[model samples]
Target: MRCPYCGSQDSQVKDSRPAEDGGAIRRRRVCPDCGGRFTTFERVQLRELTVTKKSGKRVPFDRDKLARSVETALRKRPVEAERVERLINGIVRRLEQSGEAEIPSEEIGSMVMEALKGLDDVAYVRFASVYRDFREARDFETVIGELSRPARSAPDDGA
Candidate 1:
């Protein structure tokens, strides 16, 4: 690694250790020329994800924006912010696991709808109405129909 202080290419690692979470490595390096010491961190580089819109426009993935949409949908609801974050994380993870760098915007919306469905009915409908671009009253009914489905199974281990 090049020395950040002296810009010297000749450097050696003084020490290396794993970070607390074990997701990254921290390295202390010293420049041979200037004896300058510095620290560096190394972490996995996530692959860039792209979203293809209906208008044929491709955009970089934005997780904060997606989380904000979920927050809006869950407004005044009993769901917690951490739950929303977890929902966003789960969606991103699922997309990445698909091994596709580019995903359609509609697919993302559908994923959001499915996630919100498991979260809360009202929030799911709110997000669906906006994401599905509900044109009229019948659009509302369609989502409401999906929301009002009967619960088929017992709750998971979590309360």
Candidate 2:
């Protein structure tokens, strides 16, 4: 790995172990030239993904960008960090397993919305406002109403 500090091209791994519940490998490395130490986490990619934006532009999938968007929604919320990590992992797994090399950006957003809806209500609304492009107070009210409503019960089959 290249050294982040001195931009050296060489580094030595000092330690390695499982992280993120064995979803990734964490390596502690030291830069030989600058004597700088840093940690890196490696994850296995099932396949390279391309996100097809609404504008018909395709961009390489970015895991960090996904994480950042999730974190932004969960910001200042009471949800635990571990849960957030799992949520992101689950979303990525689903995307990778979809059997498509390219995925629509809307699909990704919907996945995030579904996951957040189950994780935290406030975070769900926060993400929805941006993802759905809420333009008026009525938009917020509509979403909030959906949240407040109880789940529909199964229709009673007469005994």
Candidate 3:
């Protein structure tokens, strides 16, 4: 591993363990040159994902960008950082397991909206406003209405 302090290419791993969520491996490393210590989290990549943007441009999927968007929406909210990390991990996992190397940007946005909807109402709306491109106040009201409405129950089995 490279050391961030001295930009040295030689770093020794002192310890290694599973991350808190168990989705990644945490490694404690020390730079021999600067004696600086830092921790790094490593995750297994099932496959490289390419995102098909709305502009017909294909780009490599960025996990950090997605995390930043969610965090921005959840800013000043009651949601915990751990929960947000889990949510982002779940979304990435789903995309990776979907058996598709290229995923649509719209699909990714919808997935984020759905996950945020269940996590926090305020955060959900915050994301929806940007994702859905809410221009007027009615747009916000419409989404809020969807939240206020109750879920439909299953049809009677004629028991």
Candidate 4:
């Protein structure tokens, strides 16, 4: 790795450890030329995935963009930062595991709505408003109504 301090081309790793989140590797290195120490992180890159918009336009899937949308919905909410990070990570992992080169944008929006629905009702409504393109207040009422409904129980058979 190149040293940031002296711009040296050679550096030796002095220590290596797994990052706190276990998502990356942290390495402590020292430049042989200047004896300057620095840290670096390494992470695995998943295969590139494309997002197919409603207009039939294709674009690369962006995690930061996804996070920003979710964060906007969750703004001023009571949800913890860690929980939000986990939620984003979970959604990204699911998309990656689908093993599809291209996925519909609507599918991604639906996934975010589902995740937010469980995280915070207000956030869910906020995200749904934008995702569903709410034309009137009644649209929110409809979604809120759906969220308010009790889950159906399985029908019992004579045992």
Ordered from best to worst lDDT, the candidate numbers read: 2, 3, 4, 1
As a whole number from 0 to 100, the lDDT of residue 79 in candidate 2 is 94
At residue 26, candidate 3 shows an lDDT of 94
The order by descending TM-score is 2, 3, 4, 1
Q: What is the TM-score of each candidate against the true structure?
A: 0.66, 0.89, 0.86, 0.73
Question: Root-mean-square deviation of each candidate, in angstroms?
Answer: 9.1, 3.6, 4.0, 6.2
Error of 2 at 37 (Å): 2.3
True-vs-predicted CA distance for residue 78, candidate 4, Å: 1.0
Lowest lDDT 10-mer window, candidate 3?
149-158
Measured on C-alpha atoms, candidate 4 has an lDDT of 0.89
Question: Which consecutive 10 residues in model 2 have the weakest lDDT in total?
Answer: 150-159
What TM-score does candidate 2 reach? 0.89
Residue 130 Cα positional deviation in candidate 3, in Å, after optimal superposition: 1.3
lDDT of 2 by residue, 1-159 (tens): 999999999999999999999999999999999899999999999999999999999999999999999999999999999999999999999999999999999999999988998899999999999999999999999988877765455654665
* lDDT-superior candidate, 1 or 2: 2
Error of 3 at 98 (Å): 0.4
Off by over 4 Å in 3: 151-159
Deviation of model 1 at 28, angstroms? 22
- Give the per-residue lDDT digits (tens) of candidate 1, residues 56-82: 999998877888888999999999876
CA deviation > 4 Å runs, candidate 4:
1-20, 25-42, 150-159
lDDT of 4 by residue, 91-152 (tens): 88889889998999999999998899889999999999999999998998999986886534
The lDDT per prediction is: 0.84, 0.95, 0.93, 0.89
Q: Give model 4's TM-score versus the native structure.
A: 0.73
